[model samples]
Target: MTTSEHGAVPGLFTLVLHTHLPWLAHHGRWPVGEEWLYQSWSASYLPLVRVLRALAAENRTHLLTLGITPVVAAQLDDPYCLQGMHHWLANWQLRALEAATTRTASGPSPASAPEALRRFGSREHAEAERELVEFDAYWRHGASPVLRELIDGEVIELLGGPLAHPFQPLLHPRLREFALREGLADAGARFAHTPRGIWAPECAYAPGMETDYAAAGVGHFMVDGPSLHGDTALGRPVADSDVIAFGRDLQVSYRVWSPKSGYPGHPAYRDFHTYDHATGLKPARVTGRQVPSADKAPYDPDRADAAIDGHVADFVDTVRKRMRAESERIGRPAHVVAAFDTELFGHWWYEGPEWLARVLRALPAAGVRVGTLSDAVRGGYLGGRVDLPPSSWGSGKDWQVWAGERVADLVQLNNEVVDTALTTVDKALARAAAVGAPTPRNPVADQILRETLLTVSSDWPFMISKDSAADYARYRAHLHAHATREIAAAAAAGRQEQARRLAEGWNRADGLFGALDARRLPVA
Candidate 1:
């Protein structure tokens, strides 16, 4: 255990935002694919970046620890995605204009409908226009340079993760290692810096996983609070390795968003689900859970702004109280980590970014020290070593979400696909070695590995289990599985031409991590 400059402060707070989405490039567009990516980019990423850039201009360093999984990084930097996102932004501007001119029949009177739409359209148009400028300036080329700028400026600490955000604990050892190593390399390729820490997909863990982290040159990662058995006073070294695991402090994190209640559910906030189909905009406030979309009140920016203010102050007070209490209980200053999906702000909860900005500013003013996970580790906010249990941040804080009966078929599918892909790749490597090839960069083998990794991504099973997009999840999982199977079978059967053709097609659709090489897969 160790202490640091924060020993005198009540507690130190670190905000972790895990930014991830499965590879949606060349996938479906509406309802559940690239739309997810672009919507998050325009609503969350753009605004979040705007807020961070503002803070960075003010010279705020270590504002938070941000994890941009390699898969998401690949999309953000892909030429196809950049083009699509630009078009999406332009479409948004067009939608706003349409909304302003389109008459609706739901308002108090016929006259009221036009007035309401005009106001909504005008406001949305300006917001979309601002996002467009931001996109052209910082995001035209890709998100890499923008992200790298923040990283280099020390505005946030970037955390890397596996190539496709696989649930690590359920993955094969060799593949797990390969993904992590490749993912980190991918980050370095984009941002020019390899992250020392990772927001482990799902905050999933298993005993001795820290050894994997240590072997991969990772100094720290995250896990769930329950994995630490609720003793989240500080980051803990795992097992005998020097790798640290920072557990999320549910006490502080749940205050912003939780299952039953959170700031976003407040009536003043924009209703995420209530949409104006005619205009393709959300036009209602969360009047009440029971209120129908038709009966819900129109969203008012002033009310939402007031709600954000109150929530921000309340959150700051919550952190202060939590830190003070934890510090007194532990006989020293404590550390609190609040980890959440980055999309929750600006995407799911419309006012989330504003609330986050206010909270970040208010916390320091209220005397709560803020830092990144790296800062916490270096500041010596570490407790005794702990042998972590197999766990995830999923429901019940266990591996059931990814491996449960609800996804038992998916589990089997993943196993079968991975086995076939690995077997096929291994044979390809052996053939290469036999042919006196000096390098292991087999294109067919690479595509097999790529499709295989995408096949087993934790996102599919999660989406299925959560029922958010079960059919789409199953479709994607099987789509990749089928791709891997066909490619692997073709290669394994000595049908080199057929395998190459299949690989090329899949590569065009699922191509990501251009640097991924099957030959580089770690040997156990």
Candidate 2:
């Protein structure tokens, strides 16, 4: 017989979500900026927050560990972002209104009446208005409150990363410290909770980052196990530091979804691409006999409930088997953490909320205890020493996904931009202090500092790696490059006027990293 019932396991399963988006507000829209924020807010943030709130209301303790990178948090809390998101929701209402007017007057799906449908106050407009009204209320009223409540209640563990979410592994060592230290401080101030852990952007890792983590007062960090230098199975404390490193559990992590294959790709699921251009709602089928996106299909909760039940059963069973085997070898409770991007739920995996809710409810009923990484570590689980290989949860768990030759141009741009940033920081630090003002925690200079951190965000490289919106990545690179180059030039020449102008320009455009101060950088 199995050592557990209902497929419950003897290990800790930490469900982690890394939520990050670059500072896009005040930049542009449609192809970037406000649009990006609204899209993710609608697709991922609102729904994920709702899931957490529901779980919290049920008194689910330590439900999930979430890493909300500093940049995304900045966007969320920014006044401009606050207004823009609200306005975006409002505009969505207006569009729905417009669509309804057109349909009512022109007749639905009629080539002859297409012109009439485009005008105001048409005949078939009420349904579109309703959809918009619901969307606005769900996001503004439902999701926003849940997000704040989850944070304040301490129901979900929050994690942060370097400002603008840079790839620390290859970032300039100096700038890495600049980004992460400032980011943690910002999160603490904004959320009223200090993060002891961080989700390194892109699961990127390099040796010697632990020292920076320690210096920044960070006690723990998460990376793909392979990136730990071989500590794949559990969170391992780095040598000579209280900071702990946890790796992603591939066995269980892969079961739900992977970069290559997962339940999302199942023929029955809705297609992520290919929306009806006219209606902008998905209205097609993935497989031959699959459910069509359009038609009166109103998201049958029963069908979804059954699918979740089956998946949860299989998941619990797998955990039980793993637990028994680990107990035999380790003679104690082994820990497991399955890490994933938060966007996978409502955004990418439409039915992910159902699956998560069911799995969480069933795990405990099955005898497996659900917990976070901190609890497992504090509970006194000992991990054997092992050298983790270099791995990421990216495509192929390798650098080929991001740094491959196809992205040589982007890589070169990063190298140049970072070097410029380092130089800018040094020069700015030397020029002046705020006349006995307290030295900032980050050593990077003002304009030079903010621009540099934003420039190095892992998002640009990640987007380029996936070839998703290469245009946006290119635009972001040049934007930062200009700032980095300009700020350093002004600091070097002691041209306060020019420096202030460039800084102000950046300020108008910069959405995060407001805490960056050049006096923190040590002279080199």
Candidate 3:
């Protein structure tokens, strides 16, 4: 085995985190919508960014690849969301304080108010207070400047995707191409750095997308290990295109967290499903997978911290073994790319950010080379060319999760809405051209396109399929579809005044991509 001066292993390891969420602002709040945004911001985005910045302070470079979809980026930079998130953090602190103060008037009964819960509340209150202060000081301006700083500092590589997180394989080729270009342009405008790689929403791929990616100047993307027919140790060129497709190593990636098992399932970690209903706080530990939330053990930070250290060491060992075995099998240095949703870090797995920081720091000491996906490509870790099949990192490793029998209706709805919106915009453009009017500046057509794109988000179908929040997902999909239909109807009827009114109304709710113009809609 080859070794560095420190006698570390000789292999490449890349960590990729895909960040995305559909248009949620002005949609709903309590159970879903903007709440999802704020929770992720507080739990995942803020902490993960802090971790990277800390590493950067020590001159860590090419740490990992971060894919922030255009839609999510738009929300992060939005003034409305900025204000909403700040208020939400403040409220979170208040709720924690209330939880801490809850007590029985009759006596100091343990059942009335548990000591563990009070302690948890105190911890949460302090954390929220710190986060609130940080938000006002750094994030009041929006997430773009902060993210751009990381990119400029060489701490992370930004991976840009299409405007909305649509399943590209199922989308019309014209719309897919249009979304890809517009999405990259949006990222460029925000970060002043256009990304050459993307996370390929859901890691979904179909034939001929390589050509489209090449045309759009995309250099690399990701797919599941099965997409490469189980050989995913290195990046592979796809279908005669120079654009590289990096397959996520399920063995190593799942070692951190997976549906069946992972570090998060340990008994010491915080229980994700369980919560104290009265205070909206999770005070339970994952005592057992089969145990109900109420029956789980009270959470203890000391136990969780111990578990984090154990998992981090186990993860480092897992990576070392995989790298050595793969290198020997291939008779050269091999790369292992472990990709996960950014939300998994803190939102789903409370110890995720800490685990991430520890793993990134520990790997190098163990002789493993860690870098972003781009670094692997640049370092010549490209494997042989292979024809990738239609696949995703979802259940069944196929298109079933987003377009299966379970969500057939959503699939149909997406097709119908996209078709109607595109046709309406096309007809309006033709009429405007005939009448010597400005077609590109039509606000009604622009809103139609925006609402239509939002309707086609892959999150709706996945959510419905998983039954995590089926009702909310369905509501969001239909809500945007209704907006698209009404805007199109008004525009097609030549009711300019009515169309403008409807467009303005919808824009207040689903107005993410301010630069989204109907003129960018691809001709079909």
Q: Summarize candidate 2's per-residue lDDT along 245-346 as a digit string, tens digits.
A: 888867778788865766666554545653434444332223323443333122233455566667778887776666666566667777777888877876
Worst 10 residues of 2 by lDDT: 104-113
TM-score of each: 0.97, 0.84, 0.96
lDDT tens digits, residues 1-524, model 3? 22354377767998999999888888889788889999999999999988998999988889899999998899899999999999999999998897777663211222124676677788899999989988888899989999999999889999999988999999978788888999999999999999999999999998779999999999999999989986888899998989899999999998887788988899999888777767787778888888765467778899999999999889888999999899999988999988899999999999999999988898887889999888988899988888888888889999999999989999999999988988998998788778876655878888898888889999999999999899999998999999999988888888889989999998987788888877877776
| Candidate 2 deviant stretches above 4 angstroms | 1-8, 31-33, 93-148, 228-231, 288-305, 389-391, 396-402, 433-444
Off by over 4 Å in 1: 1-8, 106-112
Span of 10 residues, lowest total lDDT, candidate 1: 1-10
| Root-mean-square deviation of every model | 3.1, 5.2, 2.4
**Superposing every Cα of model 2 onto the true structure, what RMSD results?**
5.2
Clashing pairs in 1: none
Model 3 steric clash pairs: 8-367
TM-score winner between candidates 1 and 2: 1
Highest-scoring model, lDDT:
1
